[model samples]
Target: MIFSALSPLLRSSALQNLTQQALLRMDAETAHGATISALKLGLAPQQTHTDPPELRIALCGLDLANPVGMAAGFDKNAEVPRPLAQMGFGMVEIGTVTPRPQAGNPRPRSFRIVEAGGVINRMGFNNEGHDAAYARLKGLRVPAALGVNIGANKDSEDFVADYVLGVKRFADLADYLTVNVSSPNTPGLRNLQADEALRRLLNEVLAARAKARVRVPVFLKIAPDLDETALDAIARVVLATDLDGLIVSNTTITRDTVAGMENANQTGGLSGKPLFNLSTQKLAQTRLRVGDLPIIGVGGIHSPQSAVAKFEAGANAIQLYSALVFGGLDLLDRIKRGLAAAVRAQGKTNVSELSGTQVADWAAGKAEL
Candidate 1:
């Protein structure tokens, strides 16, 4: 009733801040559910101004109003991409949806690390199967570029087949497709990143894409926990294939930065502010290895500065989700403004010009933290 009452009120920054505080006091997953429910009811803030031209970008041939995107986990079932787009995300990715429905890990699986501005969840790609998401996405259009992130089912008989099936299911519907093999909660999923396995997976998935009526760009979403050697192998495999791009770094399992904080020992992937440095470093390393290949950076972005750091670290576009838990939807406007300022300050006409500018420094561990 309170949310319903507030729906007709002007969706202002002050109101959103109050709403965020209220949500934070609830259970993490419960609050997330409420937020999504609110979004579906059209009770969310709308971007009131035009994004400056400097923030415009073309990622893998998909034109975006800005590089900011809602990462996959936020709208796991493709429920509210349009509202998220209205809230100012230049791109919106939905689901790590599987071919079959799954209940995922047990309750209390999502934890908020308040002090560290981070969240940990073993959600295990829980989502309505392909049919549910496809039904929502079929012929649906939104202003922001839409992407579908697909994953293999937990009980999948053949993981590569699952991915191939996903490619066929979404190729015609999405502006892009992301093969997500990085979620830590899914048993043995990260192993797919291994060079040989990755090569096989991409080969099959791409083959499926080639058969689709629409050949949307396909990107691989990898984990941030990999070392330089692993990054090298992945880069080598990706470059040798017809894969369109890469989403640099997903939620991390390591928690070195949030060690003493509450929920620090949670047995799931860590995301939000603490993930920035490691993910960016990995992104830069991937950039160095695969020159000119597009990369969408995700993880640990909470402010405009952090978002800009992603581009400097070699992301052609960037995505965020956990930050919204703390910063509220207003963060999107702030980031777009910050990016526009960054572009003008650097004397660049477009934000894409900033990509990889600091990759060498970041990759070598010389970037300012």
Candidate 2:
């Protein structure tokens, strides 16, 4: 309760130090080892018997154990699925893996904007390639729903072929697949989101999914920087093509919200607290346009209130990356607890019932913010 009361102020500078200390405690190898170690310890022993079961989110016919998920880019190589699953994410999405191996952009690409609670990365879809990623996915013993984030190689001329090849190669290994056409870091990537190009790209990828004989849901990830007209067009194409769902945002190129932050001018997509409102607004707009299509909300969720805001904005589930970098692991538990408390306070039995229920309120609130 003391941390709760102080969170607003703590979120400013104190939280940054705490997160840095946490990050310093674990590098890639140690993080992986720690994750495995935690899993071996098992589910935190369910400390509070009186606590309600966390929200179970259902997407594209797959049921998740909770509404919180680790967004793509966290475990790019699919190396930490079992450990991530044990961390209690409703689901975990791995990769952004290209058809071929990629070294990504050069170092200093991923920068943490602590003051803004954001990260700007031009990591250019770095991964061990689809084959290697699939092999790792196949080898993991994750207890939670697993998804694959598929992308085209940076240097590839035939974008659609890359997606098609990925579907053919990795579809069966995943519970769901995301076609990431929204990343701003790769040259010519966001161009795929244009109306005509989107239609063609989606049609080809969906067709490839069918040919592969796999029935897993295929979702599309979009950028938050789109205007209303662009969002409408994109939604229309998804509906027309019958795609499974939409991850209503990857990151943003705009720096309007985090204008004063230290690394705010860095040339990459911006994510974290700065993107919370923008992405949520787009989520609401996309939900309005797409009607019943499920949305996986990603962007700047750093607290339970923000998670609730995302649910209110029409997200079927919520995902975060920058928050973890800024707020540390405790942020997840806090959000989960806060979300459950909010649902109970509202007299709702399930988290799904709250989805989109407050869109009008969220829109009104955003206007005020």
Candidate 3:
């Protein structure tokens, strides 16, 4: 009731901060739902400042005002991309939408690791099926570049076919499409990342893309828990294909950093502050192998420092989600401002110039975790 009554005053930093604290006290999923409801009602905080010119980036033919994007999963069913875009993300990605809707894992599927600035979720891609998301995204337009992350249904007979279907379905609706085979929640999904399977998956998905009325760029979202061999194999397969780019990681099943924390042993992918090192290292490694291909880094980017770390590690663009749980909408603006400052300090004219500058250090595991 307070949220509704004070809707017009959400732009006040003090009011928005209090609202964030209130949401943090509620159940994670309930808070998530309420946040989405507020956005749908156009009650979310709006961005009043323009992005700095140095932050502009041209990602895969899409001229983004900045390189920061809202990762998938936050707007899983495409209910609030327009509002999220208005809130300042240069890009807003929605879904991990399957061919068919499924309830996903049972209740209590999301857990917060407040002490570690992290979250563990076994949500299992619970999204309204293709038709639902497609209908919502069909005619909608937003200032930010829009991306649709797609996945196979839990019960699909042919996983590759499901991805092909996604490419065909949203090709005309989205600026880009993400082939998400890295989410740990879905059984056998990560197996799609194996070299041979990845090769086959990309071939079919790209073939389908070739038939689209409007060819959309496709990016492969990989997992953070990969060894040198697996990473090399993936790089090889990806380089051999016409895939537009790569999303350097999804969440990680490894809890090495949050070892003794509560919910550290949860059976789900871990994301947030603890994920930065591993994911950034993987991003650097992937960049080294893939050479000039574009990479959108995601995972554990909780601050502008971490955001800059992603670009220095070789991400042409970056996305964040879990951090929003702890830092609220203020985090987005803070990171953007921080990025502009960092770019100026580095004497770079554009934020894209920072990409891969520190790749050697990150890939060599020299950067502090």
Candidate 4:
């Protein structure tokens, strides 16, 4: 009954294309559920286990097969982490898991804007909670790096206490932990991104981890919609801590970039192609503020060029969610292939060399997308 033998990348283009078309025909939530079910059932195709050395990089004390990771929102629970890793991602992050389970928003909370290659979702971090996810993760085997994105429950009395619980619960379980305070779906979630709130949250989280037998690196996932002043405050707050890294963006609430697209006015966070420039600029700007802390850029990455652009914008690594929603697992393989080619073309041995090269332009808001 072990689904360990399935490889992730060995699929015919025709079959993958057909699968994508079929998924698109369903509603967004339905398509998402079906994809997770397929992965859990081990019905997805596989790829060779080998990762090119050029794309090999270290983040948060873990070696990744590649810089590309399956972003947190992809697997809300720990149901199919192994299957997703088997699908060719260098790392897989599961959950926006809270201390308690919640149903999230009502039905039709997720929407697809096909015309703009964008998605707007207000799923509200619905998950099976830390205990369930921990039980599933306790004995799981996955080939790639593993991370957990932790969040506070929507109805929790004390948000900091919830994050502390996640830190204590997953410090030994995850290769790294991401404090996701930027999600726009949960009311008052983004408030934690403010300087004092973030500082207190991290203090509690790190303190909880400090008591753990095994210390896990804690990364922060932030909102990209912050103004320069707010972003500067966040950068300073993060740089002041011993936090492991940063994921420069969750999803955006603004729709200015994809205004005329279908479902553009939906009441949720916007992700995918339209978020590219703004997110990248924020990543680069954050890099300028925090000199050596590693950052994982996410938002709007769907192509090899976009992957390379993330590195150029000061990311040490990157994560993809919305892009994969549109492109499927094949996109991960193509991105790795394309990234390796781009790195070598620039005569680089280590992919980390590509980080922050154009940060100045991006930080100054002068970088043309």
Among these predicted structures, which one has the highest lDDT? 3
Give each model's clash number. 1, 0, 0, 7
Query: Residue 352 error for model 4, in Å?
Result: 0.6
What are the per-residue Cα lDDT tens digits for candidate 4 across 1-369?
A: 001111232244433543555666767787677666666666767776687899999887888878999888878988988988887888899998999988999988888877777889999999999989999999788888899999999998889999999998998889899999999999998999898998999888888988999878889999999988998899888888899899998889999988887789989898888888889999998888888899999988879888988999899999988876666567788889888898899999978899988889887888845
lDDT, candidate 4, residue 76? 91
Give the range of the ten consecutive residues with the poorest summed lDDT in model 4: 1-10
- lDDT for each residue of candidate 1 in 1-369, tens digit (9 for 90 to 100): 011122222264534654555666777887777767777877777887888999888888888988899899888899999988887889999998999988888888888888988889888888889999999999888789999999999988789899999999999999999999988898989999999999999999999999999879999999999998998899899999988999988889898999989989989999988988999999999999999999999888889998898999999999978877777666778888999999999999999999988989999889855
Q: What ranges in model 4 sit over 4 Å off?
A: 1-18
Q: Write the per-residue lDDT of candidate 3 for residues 268-333, one digit (tens) a residue.
A: 999888899999999999999999999999988989999999999999999988887777677888
Q: Which ten residues in a row have the lowest lDDT in candidate 3?
A: 1-10
Model 3 RMSD to the real structure? 3.1
Off by over 4 Å in 3: 1-18
Q: After superposition, how far is residue 127 of candidate 2 from its true place, in Å?
A: 0.9
Clashes by residue pair, model 4: 7-46, 7-47, 8-46, 8-47, 9-46, 9-47, 10-46
User: What TM-score, to 2 decimals, does candidate 2 have?
Assistant: 0.87
Candidate 4 TM-score, C-alpha based: 0.94
Error of 1 at 39 (Å): 0.7
TM-score of 1: 0.95
By TM-score, the candidates rank as 3, 1, 4, 2
Write the residue-wise lDDT of candidate 2 on 1-369 in tens digits.
Answer: 001111221233423443335543543333433433443444222222222564876678887778888899877878767766665677889888998999988765766676777778888887889878888777567777899999999899899899998888887889889999999989999999999999999999999898766687999999998998998789888889879999988899999988877878889898888889988888888898898888999988988888998998889899876777556566777888988998899998888888998686655445313
TM-score of each: 0.95, 0.87, 0.95, 0.94
